[model samples]
Target: MANYQEHAFTHSGLLADIPVTLLAKPADLTAMISRFGNLGDAIDACEYWYGPYPYDRVGYVLTTDGALEIPTNVAYPQFMTTQTTGNNRGLYTHELGHHWWGDKVTPYVHNDMWLKEGPAEYSGHLIEEWIGGQAGLLQAVKDNHFRVLREAHLDDGGFQPLSPMPDEHIYGTHTYYKGASVMHNLRGYLGDELFRQGMRGVQIALAEQTMTPQQFRDSLESATGVDLDAFFDAWVFAPGYSVFVVRERTVNAVNDSFEVVLNIDQKLRGTTVYHEAVPLEVSFLNAEGEEFLADIVASGANALHTVMVPFEPALVVLNRHNRLNQARTANERTLIPGVSFGSTQPFVDMIMYQTNLVDTTLVRIEHIWSGAGVDPATPDVIDVSDTHYWDIGGLWPEGTILRGRFTYAGATADNLDNALVDGDETGMLMVHRETPLDPWAPYPDQTVLAGDLANGNGIVNLDVMRKGQYAFAKSSVNVGMAEVRTDLATVDLFPVPAMDHVNVQLDGGLNGTVRFDVLNAAGQLQMRTFRSANAEGRYRLDVADLAPGAYLLHTAIGEGTAVVARPFTVTR
Candidate 1:
C-alpha cells in the first residue's frame, strides 16, 4: 500500500464540466499541472467512447514509482515534463479508464478482476489507436499479442480458465492479456455499431455497481441482440489457446475462377474442446498481379470448408493480418501446383537429413527425372547431414516425372532418413517452391508445394503445365534456391548513416505498390508512406524529416507476402 503526502499544490480544470485536479510534490508542481491539462482531454476521450466519467472529481497524484487507481484519483510515478509526457499519456488514459470500469462498475469479487483490468487495458490500446491512427493500433495490438504469447509459453504450471479468478500467482496473462484480447475480438465479432452500443450499455447499466463475467456477457448480448454463448464459453471460460493447421487441400480451376477446399485441423491438447469462429482473410494472386481479397470463416476441429474466387489464384494466403490466436501457425496454406502457374512443369526444392539412430552416417540423395520422352537417368548421390540444393531445369518440364530417393548404408536400415517421424524430430522433409522469408514455423501456411518422407523416398508425377513441379527435402533445412524471382534480397536503400534523407531503389523488374513504414528504435511507427512501380517496377522514397536516431525501414512489395526489412540511422 502507498500513502500520499497531504502537503501539495493543486490545479483544477474542467473535463467536459467534470471538475479535475492535479496534486504533486512541491518541486514537481509546474510540470504536473502543465501535463494535467492533457489528462482532462484523456478523460474526454474516455467519456466519448465509454460514456460520462462516473466520478465527479478526478484527481491524479504524481509519485515516486509505479501507479495505481484508487476510486476518483490515480497515483502516477513519473513527473510529466513536456518531452516525456507524450509517451506516458497512455498510462494516464488507462488509469482514467478505471474510473468507469474499476471504480464505478467494479467486479464483485477478486475472481472477476478481468471485469476491471480487461476493459481498462483494452481502452488504453483503443485510445492509442484513436489518437495515433491505424498504425498505432496495430503496433499496440502486436505488442500485446507478443507479450501474451510469451507469457503463454512460460506458463508451465498448467492452464486455467479466464474467469472466476484463477489462483493469484498463476493469474498473469489470462487475466490481463487474454482478457483484453477477448474484448478486442468481441468488438470485432460484434461490429463497430453493435459493439459500441453494447459497451455503452454495459457501462450505463452497471454504473455504481459490480458485474461478474456472466453479467457483462448478458449486457452485451442484450444490447447487441445476438447470442454469444459459444463465444464466451470458448474464449473466456476455456483453458488452452486455439492452434490451427491446414491438414489437406484441393484446388479446381474453372474458367477465370478457382475453387479451393481446405481441411483445417485444430490441435489443442487437453480435455477441453476449444471452439472458435476463425476469421480468415484470403489474398488471391495471379500473373495479372495481386487480384482481390475475400473473407471466410472456419470453426471446430477438422473444419472442412470450400471457397470460390473470381480469379485464377496463383497463390492464396490465409489469416493475412494474423487475427487468429494460433498455437501452431505453420501449415496455414499450401501451394496448388497446377493452379500457381497454368503448367504441369514442376519447380521444386527439397531438404534431406540423416537419422540420429542410424547404423551408418553415410546417406545418398538421388533425384530421378523421367517423362515427356525424356529417358530416366541415374540418381545423383550426395552424402551429408548438412543441407543440399538441387536445380533441374527444362529437362524435367511439364508432365515430367521426379523422384527423390534416400539410400541408407545397411540393408536392415529402417528408412533412408530413419528415426521417429514426428514434427519435432530432424530428418523430416519439407517441400517448397522457394524458401520463405520468415522462419519455417511461424509462416507455414503456404510453404508446402509437396512433401514426402525421406524414408519412403519422396515421389511426384507432374500433372500438366498448370500443375507445377514440387520441392521435397528433410524438414528444418534452412536452404533456399539462389534463382527464385523476387528483388527482396536485392532491395537497396541508403545513405546508411544519413542525416537528412535516404533513398530506396527497387529492381525495375519488381512491379506493384511498395509500402514503406519507418519506425523508431522502440518499434513505434514514425512515418508511413508508399510508392508504386510502373512497368519496369522502380520506386524511391524521401526520408529527410526524421529525427536523428536509429530507425527501421519495413518494406512490403504490393499486397504480396514478401517483405524486406533494413535498419538505418540519422545522425546530427
Candidate 2:
C-alpha cells in the first residue's frame, strides 16, 4: 500500500497518499496537491450524494503524454493540467469516479464497458456543479450536447450497440459521447436521489468484483426498483438518434402566468424511434426583469405540451439541461448570401446596393475608390477621356452582383461623353456608351463634358439616358463615339498573379461612392450590381466554383476605374 498523508484543504477534507516519484518537476508539488484537492472534493460530493469512496490509494501522475489511462489506478497526464485548467479538474474528477464504477466493480468483458464509463462521465458533471456552481456546469453540459449532435451520423448502416467496446477511432460514431449522453438521460428518469442510490447500490453490491454487461443491467434494475430494459434496449442496444424539428411555438397568458405550446416533429431517418419521455426545462425571461421556469415531458412522435409559469416571457429557450440532442434551436442565424451576376456593371451595382441589404449586425463592409489621372474628384467626361474610369475595392461573397450608374454630358456636339469599366487588378476593360451616337461615325474631336474644370477640361453631368442597350466592349476600349476626343488616363493593375481573391487600392483620389462587378472566365456576369460609398478595404471573390481559367473584377467609384484580372483553378 502507498504511504497515506492527511492535510487541510479548501474544498474537501482528508488528503490521501501522494506518489511524488510520478511527478517530474519540483514546482509541480503545489499543482499536484491542488489537482488532488479537487479530486478530493469530487469524491466527497459523490459520497455525500450517493455512497462512499472505494479506493485505498489515489495515484496522480503529471506527464506530457496524450492518453488518459487507468492501470490498476488513476493516471492523468501533465499536459491536461497545463492546457485547460477546468478540463483538467473535470478529467481528474471523472477518473476518480471510476474508482467506484470501474475499478471496484470492473467489467468482466469489454462489452459491458459503458456501464463503467457512462456513470463516471455523468459524475464528472455532478462534480463540476459542486465546484463551479450550476451555471458553469450547465454550460459545459450544453457544449457536450452540441458536440455529440454535430458529430453523430445517421447513414452509418449498422448501429453500434453500447454493450460492446468498438474500436475508438471508428468513423461515424463515438463511444464516450454516446455513453455520457445515455447516463445523463438516465439521471433525468431516476431523479437525483434515486439515481444516486441506484449507483451506490450497484457499487456496494458488486464491490471488489467484475461483472458482465447483463449483470450490470440487472444490478441497476435491482437498485432502482424499476425496469430499464426498454431504456437500455432503445438507447444502448440501438444505434442512431432522433432529431426534433420544431415547426412552431405559441405562448398564451393564463391566470397570472404564461402557458407555452410547441409543435414539434421527430425525424428518426433509418433508425427506429424510441418511445421514451424526456424532461425539458423551459426558461422565459420577461422585459420586466422577471424569470420563470417550467418543466415538460416530450414522449410521442408528435408531442404537444403546455408549460405554465409566472410572468410573460420575452424570450424562450428549450433543452436547458442538454440531456437530449435537438436539431433546431431558436438562436440559429442564417448563413451569408451568395449572389451571381451576368454583367460587370450589374454586378458592381448589385454589390453596392446589397451592402445596405446585408444585416449590419452580421457583416461589415470596407472599400476604396479611385479613378484616372485627374484625382477621382475631377474626372474627364469627354469621349475617350480615360479620366472617367473608376475603381472600387472591397470583399464580398462570390457570385454577387454590384451595380451603379454615373451620368455624363458633352460640352460640344463633336465631343461625346462615355463610360468605361474594368477590374482593378485584372486590367480587363468593358466600355459602354453613355449617349446614343451613330456607331459608324468618325472619332470625335477634343471636347469637354459637364464638370468643373480648366478651359480645355470638361465636367461629367449627372443626366443619363434611362433606355436602350448601351454597347460595351470586352478587353478593349470603344473608339466609335463621334466628335469626342480626349486623352485616356494610363492606369496599371497590380498584384498581377492572385490566388482565390484579389485586392484593389486607389492611390490618387478622395474616397467616394464605389461599385464592384465580378465576371467569369468567359466574360459572363454571375452576380448583380453591388455598391458602397467611400469604402476602402480588401475584398474576397470566391473562385472555387470557376473552372481552371482567368476571371475579371471591375471596380468603379464615380468616373475612376481600376481593373483587376486574376487566374485561378478549382481542385476537388
Q: Which candidate is the best by lDDT?
A: 1
Candidate 2 regions with alpha-carbon error over 4 angstroms? 1-37, 61-73, 78-84, 152-159, 165-173, 212-218, 225-230, 243-245, 250-260, 284-289, 308-315, 321-517, 521-572
What TM-score does candidate 2 get on C-alpha atoms? 0.52
| Residue lDDT tens for model 1, 82-153 | 446655666777788888888878887887777878777777777767677776765666566555644543
| Model 2 C-alpha lDDT per residue in residues 115-176, reported as the tens digit of each score | 77776666777777787887666655655654554444422334466666564523223456
The 10-residue segment of model 2 with minimum total lDDT is: 440-449
The estimated TM-scores of all candidates read 0.55, 0.52
Candidate 1 lDDT: 0.53
The clash count of every prediction, one per candidate, is 29, 88
- Per-candidate Cα lDDT values, in order, are 0.53, 0.47
